[model samples]
Target: MRLRQLLLAITLVFTVAISPIQTDAILAEDMAIIVEVEGDPNKWKAYIEDYHPFVEVIHVYDTLLNALALKGKSKDLYDIDKEDFVRTIHPAQKYEVPNAAHSPSPIKPPKRNVNTPYTGKGVKVGVIDTGMDYSHPDLKRNYKGGYDVVDFDDQPMETLPTEGMPTLHGTHVSGIIAANGEMKGVAPNADLYAYRALGPGGVGSSVGIVAALEKAVEDGMDIINLSLGNSVNSPDWPTSIAVNKAIEMGVAVVIANGNAGPDNWTVASPATSVKALSVGASITEIKIPYLTIPLEDRKLPLQMLVGSPEWNFSKPYQLVNGGLGKEALPDVQGKIVIFKRGEIPFSEKVQVAEKAGAVGVIIYNNEEGVFQGGLTETTSIPVAAMTKEDGEWLLQKGKEKWAYTSYQLVKDKLAPFSSKGPVVANWDIKPEIIAPGVEIASTVPGGYQELQGTSMASPYVAGVLALIKEAHPDWGPNKLKAAVLSTAKPFKNETGSLYQPIEQGMGAIQTEKSINPEILIYESRLTFGKINEGVKEKKVDIVVENRSEETKKFRFDYPHHESGVVWDIPQTFYVKPKEKKHITVGLRVNSRKLEKGLHQGWLTLYNGNDEVYLPYLFVNETADYPKIDGVELTLSPFEQDKFKYSMYLPDGAEQLTIDLYEPESLRYVKTIVEDEEVKPGMHEGIINRGEFVENSYLVFVKIRNGKTYDSFVTEFQNFPLQP
Candidate 1:
């Protein structure tokens, strides 16, 4: 389904649609918001009835954290915010499944060779997501009961049958944790409880998620795997704060780092919660050996790209160019048809070739680099993509009587889409660890299929944590997290360039090493907050607890390439058995010489054959952005044809611009304000919309200063201005 339809479905599930208001008077916009009201529940209910009678309360929390999910008009929110009893009012954010892909055996437990066989036998893992297909062959045995927060029913799997169904997402996540049929999950024997927080399109509001989390805790789950999140990077965001509370209550929360990657400061909220074990995606490399295509006089080995349908043919076929379409194709009957990329979709081209009786289809890139492509619909023929150069070579050598060519799985590496971090608000190195996520084959709704993204990676870790929890039932979430972080195997990309700590964290999971270690670090990472030009040094204490039977001697080393910062570590140290030792690590920064953004390095502790790594991250505060604060936008309360906005701009704001856009199509409508000098403190303006088109528009307020830009968008619906 399209995003619009999906959003509509979510809206229908939450609130009933209302007709547009018919007067010059402003209408209230319906929205999902979290309200933290002070005083007793009875008083709050009285206040809601007395003033905000139109509000619909969703969930009420009365424990350590008191919050309520209320569906009300936007104006009611403003009135509620003004009341003294309201602590904070925030719009509930929506989260979706980050889309993953396949190797399992290589990263499985047997390959890691753990000392004890751990199948997560008794662990209760709560998959707080879209809902699971409990009856799926692989998940049935381990399926325990769960609740559906969306439908307010007990059966979480009651999902609407549609394209891009949410059931597949949750099922795939569950399979990654405990599927034990055709494929094996990280913890095949772990018990699973499905919580259908998200509906049809894998779209769910923070309100539903929080309720689901509460249900998980109440269900006595040992681990909660949240393979869903939104791009709210703030640590104190309601959902994120709740996640921390869950951790405080003794549940190990594992969340996806998100797939909004290849960019910095994109790690989503909840995952940004310091207590949650955030996971990033990594690609499992499958090496295909050179295929020997037998020529009349010689057997030449050609490295060819593997095709989908992923089948091996018994004999070789003649090669032909299928051109851009079927009409341009030569008789490709029982032949391997080569097609150039462009003009049409990759799948369509393959389908056309398949109709032309081609035994296999090869799509070559229009540009450089070999791409991995697939057919949208299943075809009897095999298909694959190759580089433009390879296609050209094959075309030129068509005269050669080619016979057949063959391929193997070699190694794996990190996926490029895995989000990078040093999380926006707090420069903490995220995605604490990486796992198999690229094209991962896991259980879908009914059977099995491959899915990809950090969604897959999160469960991989959650499954691994299940094992860790089973082996060390007494360990707290922190120790379990540290075990995973410290034991992760460092990795480099295909180019041999080492992935930054922010991108891959401590690296891929080493499940075997994570099970038991002689020494345990109190924290997986450290942050040296805001280093300014005048700050000379910062010191932090790292506590090491030796869990071994014998005393251990350790040597420490810091990153050699890190300059402008000096790391002071003890050359040698000793920790008594079963005792904790605190070591002070000092960082002297030459702030004047250091680069502006976030800088990071790792400190390694070596004890004989074992090594533990602690990552340190710090931001240079000398370089800062123009601060935009207290931004507020309101449609005219009286005139109904005007937009009023106010904001506080601190520091040098070179220019400020306000543009109007049609939210549906995201098309630029007109500029309300442009290229104006914005000064500090409260600034307000009125945009008269008497001349603009009478359609709903999104107003964007943007401020630019030097190289920094800050902007905010608000919706404005203009019902044909009253005659």
Candidate 2:
């Protein structure tokens, strides 16, 4: 009897131990989804009501793409997915604000002059973002009408400030377009419509954005600005498709290029829409005074860029050199420490100094240019960077009498956080234009606040587009896009090298030149796909249209690079009045001599005093790196009941290997597949959860294509355990 009782107790304990995991799996329902249904909308609504009452229909699109946004339990999703009329269903993805900086004077178009008639007077622009503060002095005058997709209301202005800073992002974006108070917007007189798709904390789903777009079109908005996007860079994504449709309906759309910067293939979704204007961030040359050190009769100004300028300290402090160690130095305590940039990461060096009781840290560059660095942990002290020259000068001065120093701003440059792109799969140059997005002052909930990101840059272009639309009310979206892109000023880094076309597109928008341009190009930029090593040359044509009434003579000029990439263009050409001419530009690249990366250059067309720029870019292809695509990884349940992964291999792949590892410890777990030959097509595999002991693991897929090898790594966590 006792033995039987013990066995029963063991069974009960086992069931108790696994119940939480099982419950968690059951509770993990699909709350957000987009569904496409066929036939009548009323029938679909009735079907949803009868079969899936728990599911809430958020949006219904009857025109263009037949779709509906529904939130419900996972089982209902499965049932709906199996319905005959249901075309496609996927989770409503989340998109974020890429975030912005300054105003109109940077681009010379609207000119901030009372006499300039193009102030976006008659155009209506729809801003789909966090709700706008309709009461703000600058935005109130231009507030037209909008809808709140989140709350399903007509009043789109933020209503819940007690929750947080309401309407922060939308207000800032609206201010950039039509703010007419203490700060002037790019187009002060444009009509503004606020679509509150994003909620508190600037978070919203793709369904809400789609609803906003549909409503914006229905309201007869001339242009729509989406300063938000996700990191998915496929043109076929739902948001991208919706953006294309909006363009098809004659409304121009502008989206942020995302803030996932300094890396390629980081341009966000919808921004990846070929028809939309993707704007990147650029820094303006606005100087902010930091410090002034007393030196005899004259004060020496020490201007530097602070990593976290929000953390400030003003009292004068002593200086010491805190070498790359946490070891105590008596002089460093209660003083500012100067460190050289080497031997360790900048954040680590600052951390070591902070541990040694340093009040602040100044890291000097090992190279020619100045940089901004930070500590991983938030410190009460200030930290900044100086150029190699400045650092050496400061070190020399430190040896003599104590030197006092303060901070000040220097010339504006590109924000380091601005996302770079040519976009993966297909190399499409993104960030069609750059605008001032660093430390820009714009409208906020209560007053003006300084924020920075590609988000700020996008609205700047939108405002500029409003002006262009006002000036040329009859121009199509493509013509407006071409005018802005062709007239932008190319930007070169401080080192005097032109930024890659993928980085800056056609460069900064030249509003003055874009408006009333003598000529307009059909395409914004030309993209020459991967140039194989043995391929000698390729050709493409750009059509130039003469808008002026008189015959015009033009001179073609292009900058040459040492990358073995050359462009052949006629030095001079002529176009008759109101005529179009195709200019064939030949691209020649010696791939054998060139490095395997994106190569770019500009071809400038000059018509007397007016000039337009076009950018050309190509990726030099080589077998040194394996090419892989269409990668998908998923886990069933929560703790690992099953694992499924699929990916496509290029033609040359000889072997493929898949391995699992413990990411935190970097410990090898198991090899699911090894030394397996893979053909150039969709390959998929599944594994049971029993094979993996840990709840979290990093899956690495390595491919050997010809003589080259490349690997892709992704992480899976909380997979369900097998019974």
Candidate 3:
């Protein structure tokens, strides 16, 4: 009885332990988000007016007609979360105001004159993103005809509701291509065609995005701006293939490098599609002085806290929760407030303390691993946070004297979360360039707000492409991609730096230099053909021609792996000054049943090294050809289960061939069903040998390929063979 009772207890304990875990596992798969808005824009405006320059609010509309009509006015009728707002009045025309109270650095824009000629004149740039606000002051003049592929509405172009739609993300992006004035775009005069694929939720299915690209291509868009993307895993995604086809047709495709952050090199889909020019995010640091908020008139330090180190000395203390309680105000008026990170929303944390009359609030991390949290557009008061340990220290310090310090939040080079990349899965040269993307002040759903991501980086490139396209109207998409890639500054990613060149791409796109350059231009397009599975030895053929007048000494370079690749000639090849030559590169795959996938590598060609290779040859080298490898695996099963297997033998492979099959007991059986010869990596095969076993079987294996092994016995197993 005792033994049975003990066993029952063990079983009950096991059941109880596993049941909760199983339930939790099921619950984890479900994801959801709930947002609560307590007040309207009018209520927020009274509070917003307290912050300076009214600079963060810029409305990016599809057309500038409305903004121009409004002339110069600062109204709260704008999307507070959006960037890239159209400028109703030029920066020079308006009086400079003080920067934001917590301003980091002065906003620095690329230098451009009103009369500067940019490339994209007659060309049309198709923007596929959230809807565009056609009435935006800066973007209106450049707005052309476009379609909304999402809902397919007749007036696909309508003024989206400010509160419900941040349809302005596309408009802000459009401005980057053509916004004029103190903030000059790469192509200020380029025509714009906008498409709304993503809706208010800031999300879209793969089908919608790809459909938009196809439509853009059909509409004769010279350049397509894809500032949004998901993680890249395979080359089979529809958008990926479509983008590749677009490049082949001479259409310049620019996409975002993704904002996944600080890692070595990460790549997002569409951008990873090899053919697209991937752009990364950079910050255009802008600094402004004279912006300050009054600490008295409104509510000086609405939140507050009180603590005494004399607690250890048995001092009586009272804990109280004053202020608005559940109302939208802070807590502990005029005193410091301490809060935890989880449970409550950060905005609510600030609000709770604000109503309490607390002058400051410090939030400590709730997650075991993290200790710091950044302030968002919601948080008010001189808010700061620290780790649990740091928070405790600050609490102790507060008991002595409250310290109120103003922090100047300047724009940094790159946001910590900005995605890094050397282009993962395969390090194909990506992030072809970088552009401003973090906390970028632009137009939003209602008015202006600071937003960041690769979404911002892409438009920067698009705008630049517009400039280049306008400058050289005759250049095709291939020429355009090359020009941008070649002109990019060679940059390397440091351990803890803001920009990682390989991941951020060729380097941040220098708006000024892309319009002009020195040396051989990148003007060629690289197209890859299918690589069959059976091919044991494949040859890659490429051509490098001189696009210059003088004899250009060229150096041949492509991604190298001694085991897989072998080039035809010496490292350096000279094109009779202006001659063109076809070079052949060979690759040998030494494996069988290889999986089908895309592989990419850079085939860099340069002439004379800077002072390093003067004596070798003063040849003006050519810069072009980023090579690619596209492998197509085709394996046809000969018999079946015995199709293929790899095992290393000490004696080495001599003659490999299936002899016969024998079954063992009632365990299982595996038949020598099918076998076939695989190319590139060769192996002997025995097909339809009629070798079959019901249960478990032993098969005699022989190798006939070489003279290493005469014969051997191998066992095969089966698991309810269906066919």
Question: Candidate 1 lDDT, tens digit per residue, 1-723?
Answer: 111121122232112222235321223446554556676755686667778878766656564345655666655655665567767433345677632121122322222213458988899999998888888878899999898877666888836455343346798889889887766788888899999888866777776788788778878889999998876655666677788988898899999888766566667777888788899988776444233345533232222221145446657678777776536565668888878888786667877787778888777779765443433344566666666886776766753444465554546576655776765445667878899876566776556666667888899899888898889888878888878886787777658866778888888988877888766777667777667576578887878888989989999865785558777779999999999988888888887777886777677789887776667788886324225543544443323565445554544268888788888889998887765666654466666756457456777778886776788776765445545
Q: Judge candidate 1 at residue 533 and give its lDDT.
A: 73
> Where's the lowest-lDDT run of ten residues in candidate 1?
1-10
TM-score of each: 0.72, 0.76, 0.53
Top candidate on lDDT is: 2
Residues 80-165, candidate 2: write the lDDT tens digits.
Answer: 66577777422245665622111122222222323456899999999999889888877888899899876667888764657653
Ranking, TM-score, top scorer first: 2, 1, 3
Error of 3 at 588 (Å): 11
Which regions of candidate 2 fall more than 4 Å away from where they truly are?
1-32, 38-43, 71-79, 87-94, 98-115, 149-167, 205-211, 232-237, 263-265, 288-409, 558-568, 622-657, 663-667, 672-691, 714-716, 719-723
lDDT of each residue in 670-690, candidate 3, tens digit only: 434233332222122323313
Q: What's every prediction's RMSD, in angstroms?
A: 7.9, 8.9, 20.7
lDDT of 2 at 285: 66
Better of 1 and 2 by lDDT: 2
lDDT of 1 at 158: 30
Candidate 3, position 648, lDDT: 23
